[model samples]
Target: MQIQDLPYPDPGVPDVRSGSRFLWWLGRNQLGGQIRSMAWGLLHFTAVSAQPFCVGYAVQAVVDRSGTRLALAGGLMALCCVGIAVGDTFLHRAAVTNWITAAARVQQLLARKATQLGSALTRRVAAGEVVAVSTGDVEKIGWFVEAVSRFTAAALTVVLVCVGLVVYQPALGLVVAVGLPVLALAALPLLPRATRRADLQRQKAGRATELASDTVAGLRVLRGIGGEDLFLDRYRRASQDVRHAAVRSARMWSLISAIQVLLPGLLLIAVVWYGVQLAREGRISVGELVTVYSSVMVLTYPLRHFEEIAMAYSFSRPSARRAAGVLSLERSTDTEGSRPADVPSGDLYDPDTGLFAPVGRLTAVVCGDPDAAGRLAERLGGHPAEAGTTSVLLGGVPLDELPLDAARAAVLVQDKDPVLLSGTLRELLDVPASGDVEPRAALAAAQCEDVLEALVQGSLDAEDPLDARITERGRSLSGGQRQRLALARSLITDPEVLVLDEPTSAVDSHTEARIAEGVSRLRTGRTTVVFTSSPLLLDRADRVVLVHEGEVAAVGEHRELVLTEPRYRAVVTRETQDEPASATGPETPSEAAPITAAGTAGATEADDDGAFRGALEEIEETA
Candidate 1:
């Protein structure tokens, strides 16, 4: 099957698997492969069953001393060998196809889910869990799925062999028939405990993966703060915990394995001892005894398969559940009222927080905390939020009430440090369509003429930097450069409501000035919301709303805010840049940016020179 055909997440299909139902669904997707594999497996198993019968028949012929009959028996054994070779080859071939297709289907589901959830996915799910699910979890699911059919075939072969033995030699048949069930049931009691251990181990492993991913993603920030060693130590501790869990899981499975071997060994002994006694009593002939013994030995192989299938189930069920849990994450919920596409874009209101952003104007949101700004942006975009997941109204209708596609189509929330995909500059710009913005017009709008010159001089874009090759995540570009490119992309989209979060945070003053100017002009006559403490972006906005304590504290233009709002000034200028004085996690309280202070633009230096930034910190703290 083609990789795309796998029932995975995509633009059209959001990933939404609930449990093993997903894995089973994958098998259903490749019904043709499954049917073919099952057919081959049945034939293979039938051939396997015949091998034991052939041995018993050959033994009887040899004992009779019928030379011609003996030759025919030998020929039959050779034919059985041929069947084993052919059947085994085709069985393995079909089995591998099944395994690959199952995994591909799982991968597709995850990919599609990632798309459906959009930015919300990263917020709720850990990066590491996502990684593990796509890479490791998919295969584990596939392993169990492919193993199921083989196990089915092996089980059927075991049943047929036993039934044949009972009919050929009634006394031996009864012992063999009863022995098979005992072997199959041997692992049943241990299965539950083993499954529990496996689940714990899998959950721990996912968490460990998340920790490692978090550490790596934050390595740069951690190094800046001299917290690398601390994070490293934390990672090492997590790794050790995962190792311990894995060891516990392995121990349980190992115990199960030992039991499988022991039970089968006992069964073999019982069958052999019974057959020998039957021969002594003249209840079964020597040839009959050899055939029964061979058949029982063959049965051992399938019995071992039954044990393996149980173990695979115990191990993979936990991983499956984890994958299902991710798929089952509640997506953004829409409210009852539907917003009209042509509602004449006006004030956007948030019902939960009682916050409102008036339409057809440049509105700057000044949140004491940048995170607050980001969350509000989420609400503005009609993104699914918690009970208070910012329910902003557009034209009297809540943003959440609009259909996702229509809302997204109307309002674009350009996040802080929006991800830049690998491609040429133009390729990046026209993400939605084969779009090409007139180079000069776009560069002037983004104030990226300087960037364009660099791109062209360096021969980055023989076509233009706008058309130049941008590496994955645009790593080849500077931090500020990537940010501008993202802004440019957003500008090109030209949506009605453009919500930008700290858009100019990374750029220098000159570039920031140009972008601020370009943004105002490009978005003229449309609704534009810029979330920033930068006076440049703030000064340009038609109105500014300062949020303190999760509610709007003040509303006015930049100059009005500076004079009227003290906390707003502290945040706008470098006046009060106090952020925890040290490190704190998401749970810790953080000081919001205070009132607008007089200063142009520069990157945050509060972390490096606390004493120099002390007064600035005090102003924000006082507020």
Candidate 2:
């Protein structure tokens, strides 16, 4: 396949049985490219091999002073040179095409698998490993694939040269024949040690890459905790380790390279010395001795290819194994048993936890463990990736049974740490419109006006809110700003069910309260399942269900639950039972506000909830 026609319609299932098998599979897939490369390579090497005979004949003709023989030899030399030029040029072209196309195909498959796994990908494999596989590993695999055909042609040339030398002059030919194999085999004994060192180098490099990625991603957090130097020092040590490992690997390969060169140089000297002795004894013609000598020298070029092929296979084997490991990951959800293609219409329910979200109602789930809540939210969205787990059903039908596209379209889950792709704000929000909800309306409901203003402040060119660019993962924005922007994006989707896990965790009480009220108002007739422990958010829910010890502990309105259930009150307040519960209700913002980590430890929900409600009220009044 050509580079431009890459990303095959179906990248096809890879043979992940083993690394060698995967390499073989890649070669089998590109048979035509390999054949073309080999054909041109054969012609190129054949021309190189034929040159010695022509030069030997020319030297004999010059000694005999025969005009016709000299002219004939000159013509033959010119023809061989032309053949060499043609073969060498086209051989390079074919080899490069094979390399690039093979790498492109592997990259496409990796990208497709990454998209299929989604959030589960990082959980299964390290992000740095994935990066390495897609970038450096792919090149190694392609290099091996491209080298195979050249290796074959080179081996063929070596064999043919040995036969011609034996026929032309037996003594010199035997010397060449015996010496070539030894020269090629000389490096084999050291290859095992070299490969081990190379593998160690690759491992250290991957660890360092992962560390660098994590450190850069959490730079803000590290600086906040005054631990930036600590991480930097750790990364420095990792980088040094990688460098040391690379140097060791290079040392082994250098030894092999030295052996390869030294052996061939010794072989060339032997061939010339034997041929000169035979000529002195008159056992062979001067032309025959010269021919054997030239042929032996020509064999060196093809012998080097043996070393190259060995190196390529050693490096690419591990790389292929890594790629295969990634491709072998299956979706946790079983997409079996034929089912309808349309989205099932009804309430969404997770059979595992027995959590039912009624249609057209706002249900709030309060889980003390954030990780558990995230997993539950993922289940509710029809991607129960945990093994041995049942599916989340909608309208009495399993969500996994529905076509993947339809299922995704029906339920939109906004992760706690949602990534905002780098693009203009307008492009970011220009997702598939699921309903009549306008983007601006979703933004207002999310209380992201400050985010828009921040973008303008960050960039002078961002006079237009839609024109503002969001940096990767919205890193340029504050945590709250990123959270609000993500919420707005989800709101704009307007799916049948919106599963939000800690949607307002980063925002303050006032903004969270406004968001809660806006969401309740906006999604009045839609199923909305929110996982949060904030009092402002829970108070606005139609029903609040508290999850404790991995099971539902209580179900009621936020006010009634707090008054009746101590566990529920403690979870929301983040306080011990020894602390007295305030008697104030949801409308009393001072007694019901959500506490921020930066806020006073003694500050009660009663103190902040009232302030949040009053601020919301004043804003509504002003509008």
Best by lDDT: 2
The 0-to-1 C-alpha lDDT of every candidate, in the order given, reads 0.73, 0.84
lDDT of 2: 0.84
Local accuracy of candidate 1 as per-residue lDDT tens digits, 472-556? 6765566788788788888877776889999988888767877888888877887888899877677788888888888788888
lDDT of prediction 1: 0.73
Q: What's the CA error at residue 502 for candidate 1, in Å? A: 1.3
Q: Where is the poorest 10-residue window by lDDT in model 1?
A: 594-603
lDDT of 2 at 577: 56
Per-residue alpha-carbon lDDT of candidate 2 for residues 539-590, written as tens digits (9 for 90 to 100): 7889998888767888888767765676876687675555423444355445
Q: lDDT at 93 for candidate 2?
A: 90
Cα-based TM-score, every candidate: 0.80, 0.90
Reference-based TM-score, model 2: 0.90
